[model samples]
Target: MIRQLPLVAFCMMAACAVPDYRPVRAPIPAPQPEPAPQVNPQSAKERFLRAVEANGCEVNASNSAVILAGATLSQQDLARILQELKDEGRGSVAPDGTGFRVNTGACA
Candidate 1:
């Protein structure tokens, strides 16, 4: 009986033993870098008109030329402006005997 009690006690102790458990977690993904800002490409005419407007000149476009009103620019300044417009493929600039004009739709 004494041997049986020891064995029974040992069996009870063994039955009471619990296995340790831990929850497994998934690995976190690395953060991705932000994309660069997209820049809109402007046409040559658009750039030219922007410059004209910046110089405080009002521009109007016709089928053959661009008319400038309220502009007090010198002939040399007009020539330089025309050259820049021409270099950008915006077309030639000529004096309309009144105001500056560009053959392209740069003013539009």
Candidate 2:
């Protein structure tokens, strides 16, 4: 009976042992991105006008005609742009004296 009592006391002491604890790691968040800048697209008429201006031609606002010099836009490039404008129904290009008259539907 005395030996049984000692064994029982040891079992009770074992049951009162301290518990171990561990820290848990947390997850990181992602960074936010900045928005892009806004840009306005150019119209077909605007593009054609820019091309003529780039070639150093004089644009007549009164009749929408561009005075083409000897060193102005090449014949091939002019023809291509004129054709494109015609196909899109935006305008037409026709020979007017020394320069070419451009019939742009809307200057806007």
Candidate 3:
């Protein structure tokens, strides 16, 4: 019985032994981004008038719409011409000017 008790105690001690366990590591978070700034330019009519000024051409008033000097003038073509002038940085066709002379429908 005494030998049997020692064997049982040994078995109990072995069962109660502490286990070795490694802890798990946590994951990292992602980074956030910022928004871009906006660019506000002059209106089409203003840009076209600027183009005309940059071209150093005058706008003559007559029965047939304000005529653009030198080139064949069209209402729709005015806006594109102005935009081109702005890109090239030509002439003094600024939105903030003393006189408000426009060919009318230049923006159209």
Candidate 4:
């Protein structure tokens, strides 16, 4: 029993005096938000119509055509709008002095 006593004491002392040697860990990062989706711009024809409406001009639509008056538009913008209307087969555009007209053609 006396021989076992020293061994038991040594074990108890060793267990109580042990030191940890592992590296410390960093904290977890917070979650981040996703970016918003990209949106496509409107076509030239649609843009032109919107511009006309924004200028307080009247937009008259019938079964065969759309007519507007008193809306100022640039020549380049007008040409693009006309081309867009033609390519889409939606209609054709015509400039009448101070206003513009759109013939819906088969699209009507």
Candidate 5:
């Protein structure tokens, strides 16, 4: 019993000993950047018409063409608007009988 007492004491001492422990933290992930806004083709055309109006021209878009009414714009101004639309892959613009026509390619 005396010999067993020492073994029991050692077991109790081992059980009461402070355990080595450390707090672990998970790694934080980096924040992702926001995606760019998508451009709508119909809205693009509308905005183009508004821009033309602001530049002293009246413009409207139909199924077959973009009609210019009331105000007359200089060839340079007209060309600039048409080129911008074309470069955006929106459509091809050509002068029709009384107005300009935009043959749209596809929506953005």
Candidate 6:
């Protein structure tokens, strides 16, 4: 019983004496992002239309021709979309009408 008590006391002391080994953190990185380009929505839309036409008129190819399908954007629809995009404040319009690039600089 006396030997058992000494062993138990040594076990308890060993457990409470453990060393902490926390790792050091690396330095914070600087924001290296470039400022986004700004654009006017109206001008952008016009440019997009031009880009659409510039595709050798291919914007009206089998695929897109189907989407436009004998429909023309009315004055009200155009205004609504413009306002909505303005309220939402950001989106991408393909200048070349092939791919889109979004800019959060708030439609110029």
Worst 10-residue stretch by lDDT in candidate 6? 99-108
- The C-alpha stretches of model 5 lying farther than 4 A from their native spots are 1-5, 16-79, 83-97, 104-108
Worst 10-residue lDDT window, candidate 1: 62-71
Using all chains and alpha carbons, the TM-scores for the candidates as numbered come to: 0.32, 0.29, 0.27, 0.33, 0.29, 0.26
> 19-108 in candidate 1: lDDT tens per residue?
657676888989999998997766544555655655434333431123223234444655666678668766443455433444444444
RMSD after Cα superposition, model 5: 9.6
Show the colliding residue pairs in model 3: 50-93, 54-91
What tens digits encode model 6's per-residue C-alpha lDDT throughout 20-83? 6778799999989997888545544454344334433233233344323322444454445445
**lDDT tens digits, residues 1-108, model 5?**
998999999999998896868787888989999998996545434655554544334233442123333223444555676778668755443455344434442221
lDDT of each: 0.54, 0.53, 0.51, 0.53, 0.53, 0.48
Tens-place lDDT per residue, model 3, 1-108, is: 997999999999997796757686776666667666676566664545655445434442332243333244566666465556556554334354532233333332
Q: Please tell me which model should have the higher lDDT, number 3 or number 5.
A: 5
Model 4 whole-model lDDT (C-alpha atoms): 0.53
What is the total number of backbone clashes in candidate 2?
A: 0
Query: In model 2, which runs have C-alpha deviations exceeding 4 angstroms?
Result: 1-47, 51-72, 93-108
Candidate 3, residue 53: Cα displacement in angstroms equals 8.5
lDDT of 1 at 81: 64
| Residue 34 in candidate 3, Cα distance off native in Å | 70
CA lDDT, candidate 1, residue 93: 38
